[model samples]
Target: MDNASSQINISFNFISDISNIDYKKKKDFSNVYNIQGMLNIRIENELFFSEEIALLEFYIQVKKWLSNKFDGSFYYNTIEVEGDDNPLIKFVASDNNYFISSPWGQDKVIAKAKAESLIESIKIFTEDFEEELYRTYKLNPKWYI
Candidate 1:
């Protein structure tokens, strides 16, 4: 497959039913544990995963992985929502190529792109997600220790 044709698209919306929950804390920070959202991911122009997910946990995991510097390969499992099983997503970087895969998917290699291209896509997704959280909730999430 042509690296130029590979793509990754992600978008999510925060569920708006947290009025009863105490999300705010001291120092103007908040927790995302109770927050819910529909996360949609598409790879190579095809829908890969679309379902409700634990928005905060997902963000933290992705952020942590990105902070690791994308060394050799990175793996992440989506936090199960509403009793659903976690979906394993893996990204392998080798020789300037990136291979994305999932055990639950029909194919082993769900998508492939140049290493730089794939990393850029993920960075954009993370930045956009962070902005959305701050815009909607008006509080920064307490970093996961």
Candidate 2:
């Protein structure tokens, strides 16, 4: 909560894929498939998502945004932030874009701060990943994106 402000505003909207496979897979879960595709980012204290991938090229670019390891899971091994208990988020290609939604907040934000800082914490927690995890992640494109 912001100390200066009496009320704290929370924004959260999890977009689900519009498909039986996507819907059933997501099943009201945070990490599933964004049928319309999403490029989530955070600046200041707010979060945002480029909900629509109008072009196929953009879809590929967004898919390339993440490292291909997680199985619909969202977690920073460097930090203990719990990605939803479900599988990790996945990128499924589709032509629908206008149906994109706002950049929604995750149900659980281990720390209410910038995305880069939160990622840094997780890197430190991993223990075996790297002694220079933060230093490395700092150079990552996501930091600037």
Off by over 4 Å in 1: 1-5, 24-30, 78-87, 103-109
RMSD for each model, in Å, please? 3.7, 16.8
TM-score of each: 0.73, 0.20
* Tens digits of lDDT, candidate 2, 25-60: 333322222222333434344443323231222222
In candidate 2, stretches whose alpha carbon ends up further than 4 angstroms from where it belongs are: 1-34, 46-49, 53-145
What is the per-residue lDDT of model 1 for residues 1-145, given as tens digits with 9 covering 90 to 100?
4554356777788885657346545222245566678776677777766666677767777777788887678766654522333356667776777776665544444666677777787788788877887777654654442
Local lDDT at 96 for model 2: 19
Assess candidate 1 and give its TM-score to the true structure: 0.73
Worst 10 residues of 2 by lDDT: 93-102
lDDT of each: 0.66, 0.28
Candidate 1, residue 15: how far the Cα is off, in Å: 2.3
